[model samples]
Target: MGDNIRYKFDYLIDKGFYWSIGLRSSFSHFNKNITASLLLNDTEIDAMGLNKIGVELQDQTNQFYLQTLFRKDFALSIGAEHKRLEITSETLATNNVDEEFVFENTDYFSFYSNLKLDTYDDKYFPKNGVYFNGDLHWYLYASHFNKTFDAFSIAKADIGYAFSITDKLAVNLKSGGGFKLGDKTTQTLDFALGGYGNNLINNFVPFLGYDFISLTGNSYVKAYAGLDYNWLKKHHITLEANWANIDDDIFDTGEWFTLPDYRGYALGYAVDTFVGPIQVKYSYSPEQTKGFWYFTLGFWF
Candidate 1:
């Protein structure tokens, strides 16, 4: 049970420059990302496999940001955010490396900036081109019972490439990475390997693949490759695969069986269909919360 809202306004300055601002917020019941990781040593998963409900996932977030663009999609932005991660049921401390026996009602305040370099054939989806996006954020402060957050930096990037493998088939690849610069960072700020969503926490991906894999550590990287089968002149149905892993691992104390490292993969089937002039994605990933089906439309911001 969750909802998301985003608002954006842009003001054009002359004909060459414009300023844009955005506000976003989202809510979720049991940690926005009801991922397979939620199944770890889970006494609840035994009774409800992925159907685990009425658990501690309650969380909310809000972000406000502004940007300026001068030419050719080259833009920059600065923003601040507020996050509340309250997991009253479970402890995030794995293998006893952390002593926090419970996930607290931690509050975090962050400041971040973004850079977009769009050189692809299309902004949303590209057929034969490349695109790259970058982000740098600072964890200004936070209040957690067992955790401390000072000034720390996080940098992340996403790279995409699409090309023709054959007349009937096309290929697209994506790679993303996130790393922390400070020695101490919030658990929410740690780079996790699996589960969906982009740069922010509100955009969480639910459970599906590898029973548990959101291994948070110093750094994490993931890659995806998709092959499209052209059914129409300008459209194609795609089959994609992804893999991700973290640099550090969770040392097991043999307390209970769980994935000690964040390393997993997923296989996906998706098709791009059009609603008039817009693209709609009707897809299925055994790697998501609703393991059966999901769809992404152009207007779903």
Candidate 2:
């Protein structure tokens, strides 16, 4: 609905589970770049330095997918994504050739097959069950004929388990991992653990020990465990802990944000309930120093 973001959603097939085919498309654009100084505390402290770092990035991505469920617990999905990324410099009041910084446009393409299984007691909110998802994708450099980055394969899997511990308490666990077969990879293709949705690795730690995104790499393995109790109607209290580590490729990158030297095993608390039409989750993390505020999106339960 906004100029910065444009999106359209449509289901080629509207029938329920009995139906076997469907199509979905998504589009988005962004105006994101280093508009401010790294030392944000003083934006104007170094005007020229700030302008030197002023890299305006225009990003647009269009994605579409077709999926069919030919079997009871399996779905075969094929998707294609194209990205047009342009980088430019915003030379502020002073226009000096040396001060301007820009990079060549990048055209990225991805094609993939995603298979999902839903065997949980409940898909959206499960009390006791198991869920597994696996996907493999191919990243193709369509715009470059140099062959430096022709193509590569990446595979990822997620496994989750939940069962009751007592009449009043239950335990839940989830593990995820991934690998890239080809040695060639771009920073954009790197893996990360944090933020909303599936990126929430550990229940006790949010934001990769700082913010909602961090601890990135080409390969990763993470696990989380927690006990939940429901004493009130439609409300649960959870206590949990999580641990995660990335492959050596992370250290090889030598970039802290992309792959920071981090230690997992943080503990936290969460309370889950529905407040009117919104799902409310309150999580508390007492060990992180990167100013990780508790996310209200997900809980251990």
Candidate 3:
């Protein structure tokens, strides 16, 4: 569990120019103690000296950014960020688990530029328009613990479009991807892809039917399509499908027709309540043993 702190200030200027500066910081700790057989393959289980292994992780990040927007729909921002991670792993050994695996802490600094565009008709329920956002980061410096690269670059973009198909039906399509540039990079720059909820920092992408941040990759391409039908003025039904290809290597070239490694589908019903919208959904993934049920209030993040 962890906590996040954020502060921001905004200034308005002439000719539709909007400027703001912000700071965001967070800290988290994770304890991973599990039976080796549950997570390891047969070969891995045999190699492990302990029947159970445990890992403790600590993560922290601090970021500062100054951004400006021209007109109303497009904006650009630049920021600097520092991130640190420490991991310690324990396992049993022949001599009473004397041996332990400890990885050197990883700490790094980066400068990033972000651009965004949004023309959606509604923030809670978009029946028309498009949204686009992109980010580019250059890792120019790092602590001595980082032996991977002196400098590298990462780029990411997300685009979506929604349109009304009929009096009470709408179609929504979205595609997003990211990759590392340059020959040298660090695992710290990889993307974490899974789950769906509010916006997340540090290259986290929301994909339905999976556990939160359950998948990691150096690069990825994902697409989503959904149909929303308003059978009644305040009641709705929806169907969704998602597909993606996640890779450990940087930016692979492929067409959407190429078979993807991940796929998921969901059906949902929602009602607009006095306070917000209440939704119930059932999601399925072929890779999983069974489907998942979700119930939520307010707009679907």
Candidate 4:
């Protein structure tokens, strides 16, 4: 079970000057039990285990972005973001022979930036120009609870191009890699399995493209394809369904998930609309982890 929430805002002045900001926070709890039995002729044995786990997580993030137009056909941008994450976990387990209880809490923070180039005239692709882009990211992560764990600072750079293949299809591709800036805590924790401290390595993600959507309005469909390359090459595919109504946007409700760097299967559905300068969205993710569901509500202005 989980609860989460987030708030985001962005603004563009004089058509080319841009500025934006965002924030988000969340929590989760979990439990499970299992029993097994075996029989052989006149001999029989049985075993059972019960596990209870509770996790409380909180995350706060802030971002600022500024982009300036050098001319009608060119622009330059700079942005910065800050994130803080705090997590606490408690577990109780019992088996035929042993019983145990565990508790842990961790806090982490990161800061990063982006630089990009835009070539599109901000029109329909077939009638508009193409966009070529290159950007670099510098990030820092530190954990308060675990110091030996290497604090991390890394930089990544990427180049890509985006254009509409047709009136209904468009695509973009980008590839980037990150390396540690200095000797820092590299250990990570696995909360779901109740485990601790694991080495962290540099990460690489590759580029791919797809047709996102054509239809717009009360209902729409979007699809994406991409690949992740780190320890091994992993393929990723996504399909999304969206629907809306008059009284309220069905997509505007719930809490946002706090974990951001996780790779797993996810499915979400929501409805949303605008109130003044604010936009609100709500989504539910089932199959988050076996029999678990996550709900998130977000507001953007």
Best by lDDT: 3
TM-score of each: 0.63, 0.65, 0.75, 0.38
1-301: candidate 2 lDDT, tens digit per residue: 4665555555666344554444444444444333232212233536345522344545555657777674766776788877665655554433575654444367778888888877777443356888778888787765762235557777887788988867667778887767676754343354655533422211112332333334445666666676667666556665555556664344345432342234443333434445321233333334455434344444322
Model 1 Cα lDDT, one tens digit per residue, 1-301: 1354334333423333566667767654433343333323335445445442222545667778877774666777788988777665433334666433355577778898888876676443456887778888787777755355577777777888988777777777887766667644344445544443322343222222433224445555666776777666655565656655554322223211243222233344434446422333333343445333333443333
Each candidate: what lDDT?
A: 0.54, 0.54, 0.72, 0.30
lDDT tens readout by residue for model 3, 1-301: 1243333233433333656776767765666553343334447668755455575656777778877885666888888988787656765434446755654387878898999998988654578999999999888877887665668888999999999989799998999988877743465456766666545656768777765555666688899998989999988899988888876553555543477788888999988888778888788889878777767777432
TM-score of 2: 0.65
lDDT assessment of candidate 3: 0.72
* RMSD to true structure for each model, in Å: 8.1, 7.4, 5.2, 16.4
TM-score result, candidate 4: 0.38
